[model samples]
Target chain A: MRRRSFFQVAGATVAASTLVLAGCKDTEVVQPTTTNVLNLGSNDAGVLNYAYLLEQLEAAFYQKVLDTPPADMPKEELALFTELRDHEVIHREYLKELLGANAIPTVEFDFTSLTLTTRAGVLAAARTFEDLGVAAYNGAGKLFTSKAFLVAAGKIASVEARHAAFIHDLAQAPAFTGVVETSGRYTGMATALTPLQVIEAAVKFFPFTVITSGLPTA
Target chain B: MNLFKIIAELEKVDPEVMDRLSHRRSALSALGDFSKKMALAAAPIAVGSAFNKAMGQNTLTDANGILNYALLLERLEYSFYDQALKAATLTGTLTGAARTAIETIRAHELAHVNLLTAALGSNAAPAPANGFDFGSAFATYPGFLTVAQALEDTGVRAYKGQAGNIPRTLNPTVGGAVVNLLTVALQIHSVEARHAAHIRYMRRGATAGAQSTIFPWINNADANGAPAVVYGAGNPVATFPAESNLAQGGISNLATGLGTTYTVEDVSAAFDEGLDNTTVTAIARATATF
Candidate 1:
């Protein structure tokens, strides 16, 4: 009789737990922008999409610069802007292909906070994006499960670093070199920022919410 | 009471149950359970290895290949700058700014060599003791700059090519160490890139009318007025072709509907290429000094 009572109680508990688990699973299907979060998914998909978003932001910024270049910007500078625009566009499209259905939709950016009609303004903006891009790659490379994708990210990163160095040099010949230095002597190291840190820096440029909740922590 | 005896008895009773699992899957499942139990028991050895990896401990067979290659590159770079600085060649041929830049580059390369050597310890390959011909590499100011540009650019590509291998070979049991190694490699890679741009900028300063033809970025071995001799025989002999490549990951920069007005050269300049092991090894071998 005691064993029968125990069995009945155990069965009831199991049924109740199942219903609770089902309810919890239902809540896990994150709604988009409803509670102000843009789920970036998990693992490599999340990292790639994060990269894609950054590329999109950069591509849009360069496009804007080319669309209405600064008045005092030299023809040489304008040519550079044109090249940068194309590079970012290529990067954005390639990342899009890599992400396929996993990628986030087009993100609307707001660069209105910065003055875009001046060479200094444009270069400063370029500097921010390029440096941030390099750091993003550095911090996130290990999170990828694919070797090919990691190599691809590294290849793109060095190019972005080159862009950052050039733009920084163009703006202020030697000042840009100092930015990469954090300690005594030349470490030959660039900046590296985690996803959360990068998001913090990138948030101001973005008009919409960017949810990085599901992104890999390590 | 032996577990193997019990398993053998169970296998005899239910061969079909054991047969359902492939040998590899069964072993893996056993390992998974063991790890779970180990986790519950708070195994110190596993925790210690995790700590070691996080602290940048010497890798086993897996990641050591990449670390050794990086060590080789750092050694080559360190020797390159060491010779230039010791010879006082730059004082006569280059400006103070250029000299300062080279000094900064040398210091970084030395730091890199030290870091890699320490991380690799006994596993590290012996430093190149002899047999390199940089005489032509440093014969003239232009020659010196050309070689510097090539080495820096090569260093960037070599690191990029091997970066994927580091994480792939990293022991799954000690993931943090892999991240540590990658972080070190990337830090050096970006710095090398900046050095490449800095060298290009200095080279541009020497060009006629400072034409800005090179734009301080890689172009189809643009040579940007660095004489054809600069791409001479002894230099890496083979890996130069990929430096000018305009495509990445089988995707052409000129593919249709890309919607960009940038020319092929512009697109090529925007992306850097990764060099395979043989190519990087050859390049490193070509640069060593006796």
Candidate 2:
């Protein structure tokens, strides 16, 4: 659902409180940077805002997929993507709640380059996202200050790993299996990306000055 | 005099007041030689675990504690997987496919235990004489299922708990030892997931819903996963009386929180919270008599 539509619910009030800074008057809507960029403020909440921004982008992308699915998309693939979409939504909302009262402003994304019409394009993007998330967790694990935060990050990272594996499995075509299970097309390559690297790649994909300072400097 | 004799003579001298002349040089060199060998003897077995002390007290959870701890888990799984491989008693006659699948998983578990032990090197405590108390509770199917579920679940949590430490660079000799560790951890998690599913299936049907299931809370009655609890993403782990947690939580309601008096929700939350690999193994070891 669009942010505006999501805002219709009463839970949105509680959820909205988590997004904004304590006692802030201004709800400055930062327009999408280019067609795909988001701007995160500078703080701990900003880091979360950055993640939230990614989730928004991912959720939007998959929603688009569900709306206008691929011709070759089977029922199973369709179901999996649907599940992924719900997961992204849950992740997005979860972060929204976690960042309570300090959540950064909402941002937009640029997906103009991605060919959303085809199954191949969609799956490739999923691969990039999952890999990026894995690396992001690995790289950022050291950055989190709270021990609980690190543990939580770990839980998400494992899920990201599983997601990466799934995307990689789907990418396996023809007479090949995955390297972990068997030799396949994307066998040797990492479906993972480090946090700093993910940030850099994200910068290329989106137009946002992500200010990361308040998050744990573990 | 022979070296042994000279050493015996040297031992007779007062160590507190060594001779300060050139003649004393030989004794000092002898002591140095002995110290060097001492270092060599302990180096391979426990180098990484020891080097954790150099990490400057980030948290007391050091390499030695973690490495040996993981070794214990691998050993447990190794036993289970090995036994299951030969197990003719898998809900009656085992099909060839079932046997192969379980065996493949078994191989992976063995690899995990072996790899962990190797990492411990000489530091690894000697293997337990019999190894693992499967528990009299496991005498019945449900009892065994509960223990198996706990073990597989523990393995899942254990790997996750240590994933953070993987990239911490215990040995600078090889680049990205931590990354390798993370990879192994992920691999282990996947295999354990498969195992949990298998065990769960053997207990209830493969498609058993969360609704119809009846569970016994023999362990983790007080808490489902850990002391700290977080609902979903971006939330910090809630603190307990002792150590502050740092888990990056996502699933709000995975299992009900594992405490003495748990409801379905509590177990689900606990499952959701997940026990870190180190903590799970520690818990298992603490609970397991073996």
Candidate 3:
């Protein structure tokens, strides 16, 4: 029995090390080598990396819009987007700082899927990023083993929710009724998505694949 | 049989077993005595009952405390909006967008109250001792929006303060139920933030000078005519800092880390700070006037 248990432990350790090696290789290679996998590491690190990637996507999106805003965009609307851009940049930089050594390299996104030349289009895209961000943080909250990380994530989560509300209101003015769970046991609660669900939804904007299997499901 | 050994074995399966047992130390001691008095088969039954009792009490003492506090805030918000919507004075002055937003927010608040009450079950906090009176807030549109923003922003901070307290476990069966509490709290927390942003949007549109300062997200400790306590720090200012706080995770100057020329207000608006339970309760009670 003791020998069998030792073998089982050794087998698990080997498998874990293989996974770590694969993750490291994925990060080391810049070019898409058949599959450019972005492995969000395990446990709290995985959660932080996942958040950092989302912030990167958001910061990049807002920066693009601010760089070349639509002609029809009003001054007030432009100002709002500037704040959104600043917040996303701050979030991106802060998260990158948090991840430090565990942080994935700065991602090069493919924003071709989005329509950035028109006012309505910009609002629509902003709505998508903001809503997805809120749901991502909400879903990822329980996966954190560290309370400080959880608290820090919570701080950003609400801010993202606020951004979602503002963007949603702009996209659908006079009738924007904040993001609520329309159908569920918690009907009035906010919507939360699993990391897998979030990645699936957000994969279109990514130039490469994001492997979230390393992340904690619970 | 050794109770400690049994617990140790259970802990291997359910890591949160210690958390569940710690809350009911007296029950654990009683469990040991009861186990010795019973047959081996009966010991398992007694052990199960003791654990259930422990978990139930812990839920009441910890999780329920947070939920009940949330319930009170929800009730307060629901009542505030309910009263505003019912009042012709405020409704008369509201724009189509403002009225629609308030109605939607009021419904969401009511739904939140229902959700928390269901989560708390019989342990739900009773209705506020004193009825809510928005005072002159009901007399005008701006007044209503100001109070609404304060309430919603406070609700967001209050929920964030309690996120760490929500329990989770590795036990697949019971873990789902306990973690669901955390999930529900988070879901509600964001909704409160959404409401806060919407309220701020309406307020900014109504007032001219409020644009630069009053965006959907909070700007520094600028209370914007609501209660000052809503934006100020809690009892332990270090743990629960004011809304203008810029530092996070022991990094003193966030601007230095971000390598940006962002002002104090910009840095402050980047992150929302939490208000501890004591501060949140005092603010809520002060606003709960008839």
How much is A159 displaced in model 2, in angstroms? 3.2
Chain A only TM-scores, each candidate in turn: 0.80, 0.68, 0.82
Candidate 1 Cα errors over 4 Å, as ranges: A1-37, A173-186, B1-61, B130-133, B168-179, B207-211, B221-241, B244-254, B257-262
Q: Which residue segments of model 3 deviate by more than 4 Å?
A: A1-35, A174-178, B1-61, B169-179, B207-212
Tens digit of per-residue lDDT, candidate 1, span B1-290: 11122122222222211111111232323323332343322222221221122111112236778788788788888888878876665557765776777887887787777767767767888875673457766667776877887788778877866675575334321212333667767878888888888777776675323445666666555655543322222212222225455444323333342444556766667667666556666666666554
Per-candidate TM-scores read 0.73, 0.53, 0.79
Better of 2 and 3 by TM-score: 3
- How would you encode candidate 2's per-residue C-alpha lDDT over A1-218 as one tens digit per residue? 76545534533223323322121232333233454333454333455566666677677777888998888778767876765665565556556545544454555566777777887888888877765665565555544423344444555554555455456556642111232332222122223344445677866556556644334433
**DockQ of each two-chain model:** 0.20, 0.05, 0.24
**On a 0 to 1 DockQ scale, where is model 2?**
0.05
Model 2: per-residue Cα lDDT over B1-290, one tens digit each: 01111221221221111111101333323323332333333322221121112111123266666667667777776676565444444444334443454465556566666656656667777767877664453343344455665676556556654555554334321121433444444555544544543454344323222312422111122222322221121111221111111111311221211112223322222222344433454566654657
**What proportion of the true contacts does each candidate reproduce?**
0.36, 0.05, 0.47
Alpha carbon lDDT at B7, candidate 3? 39
Candidate 1 chain B: worst-modelled 10 consecutive residues by lDDT: B15-24
Best by lDDT: 3
- What share of the reference contacts is kept in model 2? 0.05
Worst 10 residues of 1 chain A by lDDT: A19-28
lDDT of 1: 0.63
